[model samples]
Target: MTDFDIPSFLKTLSQRAGVYRMFDADNHLLYVGKARNLKNRVSSYFRARGLNAKTVALVSAIHHIEVTITGSEVEALLLEQTLIKEHRPPFNILLKDDKSYPWLHLSDHEFPLLAYRRGRRGGTGGKFFGPYPNSGAVREALNQLQRLFLLRSCEDSYFQHRSRPCLQYEIRRCSAPCVGLVSREAYQRDIQHTEMFLNGQSQQLITVLQDEMLDASSRLEFERAGELRDRIETLRLVQEKQRVYGTDRNMDIWALVEFQGVTCIHRLVFRDGRLLNSKNYYPDNLAGEEDPLLLLGYISQFYLAGHAAEGLPAEIIADIDSDEMTIVLDALRQQFDRSILHSRGVRGEPRQWRAMAEENARVGAQTRISGHQESLRKLERVSQLLGLDKAPRRIECFDISHAGGEATYASCVVYSEQGIASQRYRRFRIRDVAAGDDYAALEQAVERHLIRMQEASDLPDLLLIDGGQGQVGRIQQVLERLSITTVHLWGISKGETRKTGWEFLWAAGARQPIIPDAHDDGFRLLQLVRDEAHRFAISGHRKERSRSRGQSDLENLKGIGPKRRRALLLHFGSLKNMRGAPREEFAKVPGVSQKLADQIFAQLHGEDRSV
Candidate 1:
């Protein structure tokens, strides 16, 4: 079994209830389970003896684990079920449920019924929600519906035959439409709301419920308003169940996501109307971009060559919805010699499956795109995109920070293959430039840095500036005068909204910017470095600004001694007041002479004069 720092992880684990997810080396979610006491449950996995084959196999594949704390055991159970449905990990399938997952079935009748229906879902339903993790979850949902909607759960035959209000009606669990105690219109309104919630228009239904609640409160119907408020809360809990299920058995969904110049295609396998397995495939030599044709080619090779571990499904749904899928669909039919259903522009429940598949792809991509290996890989891709001989080992980004126009400072953040060369990171105190001039400030900082590089014979492979063409141009002129040509330059320009992953990238001497895909790894690397430089620069700027404001200018003046400077400050109250005072006001200080007053006056007012 792969070694896990179980002791260390358990030390940090809380005794609270929550869900823990196990993952393999590839970051594929291995298993998800809920616990009453998270620490005890997770600890039992590493008991060191008397484990079953399934447990041993699962543990062997486990590389790491993550946890999410919830309010209570019941909450953890619901969350566990949701996550299981969302990811459908392989190890979870090993522990089988005694029966098929339960669904909250609402019957089609004049007085509709909301009840739990297990086993087959479609053949005998009016409206169906869930395949909830357990029977308890379904029951809870049904109870909530009975409380809020007051719909009947009695069999149609009994409902039709009722002559008087039943126990359910007396207790406010049902509207008693069978007894004609409630109007058909009023009964139908409740049905409409239930339907709206099942259809995932929860916000729309909540709005109507709240508005009605407000109206009831305005009319002094406190009881009705209170009931409405309870309904809203119940609605939130029940609606947590995703409506992504369908009756389609043995289906496959392929979601391809390209992040940070890497392409990952995730395949979700559905067998016997259950999510059997979810896996991500990083096709070799994708070279950091997603092409529709390449995606189609991958799909062709994946299924046609019998690479599908679960075999060809009854239907294949892809993240793409372009006309190019037509060719692939036709090819799949010819290859398999059967009428296999292929769709991209899906609607209803299958649409949710498509969305779920894509979301899983993204999650998988994020896991694959993080950590030291991915960083090194990204640096290589960046070098390739920038047309460099090898991956740039040392990269730096520069940013300028100031308080409107004062206390200007510049930061140079360093990034190496091992990640953040913090020891090499440097911040410059920008001086001798006009207060508000950012261009001049940046120029001065870069010039000084380049001079240091020249002196030490050490230069960064790539230099990144957190500005548009103007800042890049300013830096270019500095490099030109210094005759430095070994370094590459990039400028990042943010949009007015300043959203991440959408910055316009400018390469020096290029006519147009290199605007790669929004989630491109190369672009993300630049954003990380730029953001780091901004952080360091702003922190330094704040400290420098505060330190400057705290000190008196008289301390830096050569001619003024401590005692005389103190007397002048005491008389004037502040440097601002003293700067405005004339030579006569300076001599008014008890310790100052007339001659020394002229010198003090000239220095205080920044006016050069012969003393």
Candidate 2:
């Protein structure tokens, strides 16, 4: 066993009974485990049989470890799960699906019925049978519930105010509870039966339905008997579709696959004793590794960062069993304060579930890799068409906008190898330029951007303008005058009919036009960048134009300085209303004295006024 120093910071704790945590150089939690005796369990890592290559590597980078004392093994286990979920250490097997489970919510009323719900509970009362894997499964169960129970599914407000049965009643989907077509006692009986059906008491429900149908038939209630018969048939069909039948336990089966330098984690969720949804996750850049270790890391990180334990299931089944697995289960138990079984199976149904999940993960990783390859190919093609030194890994596009020269603004949008670099995008208001002069606006925008970049030493590799030769020429002249030599600039000219795909590219000092291949990937890439810049510019321009318009309206009012004008506009929501207000309302403006208010009101209304 290789001995390593426990950090001086963590050495003071009582190491009697509890779980300990290990973290790597990046401060990512690598592993978490508990022991009956902390000193013994932790010291085992330094013993002759203590370390493997992976653990040795992990220990070398061990920056820190933390420990907590628990009264019992159960307590330790529980605490372990809680911390694993919270910290999401890198060396535990993680189930990465974070999607909220869909649920079938039954409204509590005279005629309680089913509806699909997500997130926290806010709907009126009834039992919820979920977190189902997806909404489709919830819908399917809901449809069957409606057909079988004949409960009203309308909104409570609408149901209370209704004077007559709606279309659902006509179609026999609802029992017209809103209109008193069904007695409360009968409705309660139906609700009870629906509960039983969802609780995996299908056989009991079938028996009860059969007896009801016989009784209805004997009493010459043929319509009631036919309805009962239809409901029985629906229940029978639903039963046939049930994949797994237990006592209504919800569980999630998780599996991890490491292949071809990628790692994918798959989750199969079971709700109401039936398989409801399957999810696949491909964690980024985890290729070429031992499968078990990768699986362990994924499990720890994923659950810590996911909603799995918060949505606490009865059981969790997985393929790999390691010391880290025990630590994770313990952590989850502690966090939720519930005994959740973590099971491992070498054969049988559990194995099959694990296999399915792993296969799904592999497929998901393959799909992601393929999509990324295509994106890179398209970017490369774009670079070739533009005759760039290399693929424009970092492209900056610009657009200028103004409302007939008011509030002139320009925006720069950035795109990198990973797509839109929104954080790097910037907007500029053309200050030293005359209104409605596109050339001046373009030059001002270019100069502002270049000066900032020069000061900060952060310039883009490529510059794209959203106009033809004129705007492009202006930008080029500005760059030359400023002696900015590092960046390449080009202009995107709109097509002949002002449509896409027919645009031309204009570069500085080039007499020949560069027309990109219409069907080329490079063209598509450039188009996306150009369109995004235009969108951003237009949006900024609209905001500035609105502000200028508001200022103009305020200027029309007499004796309204910046402070008072801003106050009035804020209070009134718009300048027109501020201008139209009575003297009494104007007096309420934060800074307006009574004399000023009266004068302002009279001036706005065209009465004898004073300023």
Candidate 3:
């Protein structure tokens, strides 16, 4: 393997465009690359002169090389991604967030449920409105949809058991169907309006609503007319705010910013004239790559990934154009069952979208570089202290949090040289673990995280857990079970005094804790990772706790199902106010019959009296 004949292999390669794979001494895939001319590309690596450091290292490690000829350069580019994904070679620039972004799903139930879904598409048949820029955008969209259409956002179980209209009904954000306050026919109509609004058919909806409003007014139904007028106005305002990016084209704009070999990609999504959402990506190991190749690789992974394939736009605008655009367009058309356009230059909204993406990419690059430089220094010190091969570029830290053994959560926060890799941060809802069992929770989180990494080369170079030796032992057992031995695992724990300055670093097989100086950069870096994991876990736990507490309180009130519970909460704004509200106020709620209101009042008062 050491005496591998590169010259002979280069001589045998054809000039045809294709993909090339480089393997190390043990036949492990070191890199997967593509080129327009297989012979020239392969020979370039074996050139007697003008080789960069990265290429030199790659060439030096190459024990064997393989190539697959393609019909065209575009085919080569497409094949390259397939090989990279299949082999997950260490040298390729990988998409860090392997999972898909969140999408807003409209369920197919009788009363549709609007939900923020991530990962796999639900088996339940319905329409998905987005692969939004981020979860925040999805949430915002869901909120807007609820406000606009007043559709029920509750689960089936809750909807089925509803005794009366919920808070959403009281707040005019839902047409209560739970207790027959709103008929199926009317609720179905609202669902249609919601679909139209989300699908960018707001103009049509406004026209219909306007007609209804006038009809209601002419029929002397002033109250109904006013409601229709308000709905039409809301639709108009939303449409006005979202200025169309393109006159007729739906486009996805991608731009890149590179600093010191690190690259940041900005994606701007515009649909039906409106800028839907924008997001930024930090792909690793992109230094020395040409703009065309880099952009091509990104688009391949971006759209090929399941989450991204949804709601495909008709056109794509990139800051850089390449020979691969035609291939990408072809692939996208086949994937989405519609032709897609690719443009490197454009005017109007597309140009604006690219400008926005470029600006963000530049800012993101600056942030990435500054953070990466600072982190490298810290990582170097950490590597030396921990006696590692080299600096740790990727570090993952885990922490567990619970509210009195309820609503437990485990958070894994990632820290690369580029500071906080928030996109890679994962939060696990601890379902199987017993309440308050931090060890079990940590073990479960570590197990699941490792299992996902089993087939991927993107495993972190270092691992940190927020606890003492016991927690470290639990994680060690998980690694052992998973047969992962290369990852460096350590535990950060508050020392004897339970204070910041006296923190203990417990590593595997270490006889005693290694305490770095308080001011040491490595220790500070560790603190950053540990603190982030703790904060993330605590936040998740708090959210879960709040939801559970809210649901529990409402569920305990006799005859107060999801709908009635919602109505009371909306009208009163809180449990305290709901308990204090006069029984007559409850009766005024849309779905609350006088008898139901009396029962609610009696139940609430009885509990207060008993307490």
lDDT of 2 at 477: 87
Per-residue CA lDDT of model 2 for 540-586, tens digit only, reads 77668768676354565568888887666544545555543323456
- lDDT (Cα, tens digit) per residue for candidate 3, span 61-170: 88876554433343354446545655578877753235465666788787788888884464758887644434665676677678767778888889899887788888
Winner on lDDT between 2 and 3 is 3
TM-score of each: 0.52, 0.37, 0.34
Mind giving the per-residue lDDT tens digits that candidate 1 earns over 1-611? 35555544554454556678899988888999989778789888888898899998988898987765443454466556656766678888733443456777778777777878875655785877765656876687688778778989898878878889899988999888987888999988988888888765666666677678779989999998877766665565455533223354788888777655556677767776645555667777546334565667788888778888777888888755557767777787888875667777366456656655564555445445544566688789778766678889778889999978888999999877655666678999987889889999999998999899988999989999999888998899989999999998888989757877678878887667776666666677777688879878976787787688895566645567787775554455457555544334456466777667767765553332410
Candidate 3 CA-lDDT value: 0.69
Model 3, clash count?
10
Residue 138: error of model 2 in Å?
18
Best by TM-score: 1
* Ranked by lDDT, top first: 1, 3, 2
lDDT of 3 at 488: 96
Go through the candidates in order and give the C-alpha RMSD of each one to the true structure: 20.4, 23.6, 21.6
Which residue pairs show collisions in model 3?
150-173, 165-563, 166-563, 166-566, 166-567, 167-566, 167-567, 244-273, 245-273, 372-417
Score residue 17 of candidate 1 by CA lDDT. Answer: 61
lDDT of 2 at 512: 62
C-alpha root-mean-square deviation, candidate 3: 21.6
